[model samples]
Every structure is written in C-alpha cells, then in structure tokens.
Target: MSKIRKKKIKKTNILLGFICVLLAILLGFILVTSYKSEQKESRHLSEIADDQQSGIEDYEAVKERAKELEEISSEEAEDTEDIKSKNTEDTEKTDTAETEDADKTEDTKDTKDETAAAASGIVCWGDDLINGEESNTYSYMAVLQKLLTDNGYNMTVINKTLQGGGTLSMMKMAGVSDETIQGYITRHQQAANGAQLNVTETGIRDLTEEQTTRNDMDCIPVIFMGYYGGWNHDPAELADQQEQILNTFQNKNQFIVVGTRPMDGSVTSEALDQVLSQKWGEHYISLADVTAQPSSTYEAQQAMAEAILQKLQELNYISKN
Candidate 1:
C-alpha cells in the first residue's frame, strides 16, 4: 500500500486514457467522411433538379404556342359566324343583277380568292383519308379533320376508298352488282399482295374523275395523301403518278402533293430516298416523323397536337391577307 503500488495504478490509468482518445479520433473520422459523402450526393441531386427545370421550360414553350393558337382560332370562328349571317341575308334577297354582283364580290373575297383558299387550309386525299373506319391512315385523318372543323371548315370530308368509290371498297355500297366489280377486287388484291379492296376499279376511276371535276369547281382544295411504297412499287414512280393524277385536276391552284413512306424501316429498302430526302420530311409533316412511337395517353396526343397547332399558327394560315 506504499508509493510504488500507487505509481503503477497511475500508469495503468494513463494507458487506458490514451487508447480511449485514439478510438474517439477514429470514430470522428468515420462520421466526417460519411457526412461529406452525403453532402456530395445532395449537390448531385440539386444539379439533376436544375436539368429537369430546363426540360420543363422547353415543354412550357410548347404550351404557350398552343394557347396562342386557341386565341387565333376563337377569333376566326367569330369572323366565320359573321360571314355566314351576311351570306344568309344576301340569300334572302332577289336574284337581281345587284344581288348577283354582291354575291360575286363576296365569293371573290371568300371562295374565289385562290390565294386565300390555298393558304388557309389543306385538302387531304388518300384511299381512305376521309372515311375508312378501319384504316390506320384514317386515324391521322381524323385528327386533321378535327383540326379543320375546329378552325371553321364545315364540310363532309370525303373518303374515296369505299366500295363503288375505289378499288378497296368497290362493291360494298348499294346497286353495284357488276361482275367486273369482283374482277377489279381480284386484280387489286393481287396487286396489293393479298390485301382485298372493297371497291371496284371502275368506281375508283369514276370517283377520281368526279374529284378531278370538283377540284375545278373551287369547292375545296385537295391534297392527295398517298403512301410512297406499296405492293413492291417504287416511291419515285408513285410520286410521278401522283403528280400526274394531281395535274388532271385542271385547277391545281388549291392542291398540295404529299407522299408518306411506311415507317417500318421499309423506306430505305423501297428506295424512297428521293421522296424522303427532298419533299417528304420538311415542316415535320410526315406521319412517320411525328407518330413513330406515340405517347401512351390522350393527354400526350393532345399535347403533341397542341404543339403542332402552335407550329401551324406560327406559319400564319389565319393572318389577314
């Protein structure tokens, strides 16, 4: 119980204290390293959020464009209503020369103005661009038809691909029991690589002739939307034939020609580079470009449609001449 035993106990206490200090230092180092790593992760997340904010801005730009188009469309609708009222009043008057002259003037301003008609809206033509309930081509047509209707064009958009009307739906309509109708369907099926047409060639030729005449009547400008390649045909050759068909309209002032190649990677195989590279892909109008992979919901389609409407407004189809 003397001085030597007391000194040994003091030495033991000092060694224990040294070990505890080293342990505390190691624990503090671990905690600091973990905190720094978490701070780095938080900074990285902040950067990601900033990038998403930029994307939102781009999307919002599209939205703003849609809103502008809605405003323009509303104004056009009001103008259309006023014009209809004026026209109604004119119709009630006598068929005198003054009335006729007034009518002519009005027509010149509205229907007879070739430049205005051509610039204001598009007339789309395809086998079923107007009325094939089952055709995929009609899906986009419905969208376009809705656009035209929304913008104040109130006409029944024709679907020339039906029976007794075209090669596909030739015999589906009434009183068309010509045996040649069956023959036409057979030929068309063979040409279409086993795809049957419900229409007869005679009917199609007749409809084509009728449409040709109507194109001259200044009723509505027509745009024939045909596939570039079908049944092993060359796109360039088809484009040429389409050009010829369009020329038959006589009054081609209100017509536009557009050819869409299938987007199933067949455009390259079918040698449609001329159609694709030159006139097809411009203005983002090709169905392939906009609809390769559609968004899952109507909301997305509506958003995309709105974006397209904005782009069209920018083109100024409704601007005063």
Candidate 2:
C-alpha cells in the first residue's frame, strides 16, 4: 500500500458519514409536522359535533313553547264560547219576564173595566126638588142623570115623587089607601102593623107598614119633608112620625134626606131639618149648602144637580174620575 492510496480512502469515508446525518434530520422534521396537522383536524370535528347538539336542543325547546301557546289559545276560545252562551240565556230570560209582566198588566186592566161596567142601579125618590115641575126640562135629577151618562157610567134611575105631600101622602101615592092605614092602626093599637099598614104624618102612628113597602121596592129612597107642617099634627107627634119614617129604611137601604126650601123662615122647618140631618148622618143633603138660591132657575137647578152628584161620588155610589 502506498501512502497516496490510503489518503483517498479516508476522504471517501468522511463524505458518506456527512450525507447520512442530513437525511435523518429531514425525516424527523416531516414526521413532527404531520402529527401536529392530525391533532388540529380532530379538535375541529369535536367542535362541529358540539354545535350540532346545541342546535337540536334549541329546536326542541322552541317546539315545546309553541305547544304551550297552542294550549293557551284553545282555552281562550272555550272561555269565549261560554260567555256567549250565558249572554244568550240571560237575554231569553229577560224577554220572558217582560212578556209575563205585560200579560199581568193587560189582565188587570180587563178586570177593572169589567168591574166598572157592572155598577148600574140607582133610584131617585123625593118631592118637587127631585121630580121638578111637570114642564121643567132641566130638572136636577135629569141633569144628574145626564152627567152620569156622559161620564161613561152604566146607570138606571127610577124616579118616585110626590109634589105637595109629606110621608102620609107619599104612602097614598105608593098604593096604600087611607082606610088600609087606619085598619093597621086599629089592629095594632098604636103600634103600626108592618103587613097591614103603609103610612106616616099626622104623627099619630108608627110607619112600620110604610117601611115594609119601601123595602119591597128594593130601591133607594130620598125623602123630602117640611112642606105641609106635618099635616096639622102636634110638633111632638110630627117628630115621632119623622123618626119612625126614618127608622123604616134605616138599615134596609141607603136613603137620602134633603133639606126643605125655607118655608117663611119657620123655626119648625129649621128644627125638622136639623133632626133629619142628625138622623140621616152622611145621607143628608142640603141644597142651601150647595147654592144659596132656591132651585127655581135652570142654573140654580144645575148647580144643585152637580152638588148631589158629587155627594154620590163621595158616598161611593159612583166612581170619582
């Protein structure tokens, strides 16, 4: 071996060692870069999965909320229906009540009308004050009848009158003869028989017989005395006769007693008038109290008629307006 050949082999060995070190460094660098890239990709996939789960949860929550709102809407709709049904029932009940009230009012009116129509009986019994002169067209009684008719009353009036007489003459007019009256007094011996006698005045006898006849008539009587001075009898006897006449129809029928026209300003007339009024109570009517004038003129007669009608209304013999 020569020295020059040994030196060339050493140089070749050093070159091979240098090339191997460079290749190893390059391979390690490449392996490190690949591992870092794979780790980053795994982390990105995990983040994507988390985001998807969150979205699913949010969607389920929204769906539940929507179901609750639907239930609330359904409940509100049912409440509205209930309110409408209750309103309809209330309206029906109100209408029914109104109809019933109308029916009752109509029935009451009908009953009142029938009751008004049923009052129809009246009688006027008196002397010239009620009967008037035979020629007089506007008699007080006639005027009263006209007024009652005009005011829509169904009334029937029967007039019984004696022009110039007291109780005894009135009995004669009612079909009782003087002999029949005497027979009654004779049979009863000062106590007048109710069946056999019909009488008053002369003051000698009771008037039970005359009263029986009036009751048979079934009518209201209006008696007017003080015209003939009790047919020439004693004042005490006349007073007794007057009392008996009044007692005859006291409770049997509602009768009227009229004050006489002032006859020469006699005290007996005044006394008789007072006694009659005291006995008759509210049934007594005084023409002087109504109008100070005698009922000779048409106007005075009409005024008296109006007063009498008003008294009748007060007595409930007729309706007052």
Instruction: Identify the leading candidate in terms of TM-score.
Output: 2
lDDT per residue as tens, model 1, 235-276 = 554454444444544344334333345434445523554563
lDDT of 2 by residue, 1-321 (tens): 989988888888787777777777778887888788878888888888888889889889999999999999999988998898889889888889999999997776655445434434455544554343532557766776788788775565555554545655554445455774455345443443344332233333333454325432444444555554433333333344444454444233355566654344434445655665666678877666767666555676687667776766555555534
Model 1 residue 71 distance off true place after TM-score fit, in angstroms: 70
After superposing candidate 2, which stretches have Cα over 4 Å from the reference? 1-120, 129-136, 174-216, 231-253, 261-265, 268-270, 319-321
Q: Would you list the C-alpha lDDT of every candidate in the order shown?
A: 0.47, 0.58
| Candidate 1 wrong stretches, greater than 4 Å | 1-114, 118-122, 129-138, 152-156, 162-232, 262-266, 269-273, 276-284, 294-321
Candidate 2 has an lDDT of: 0.58
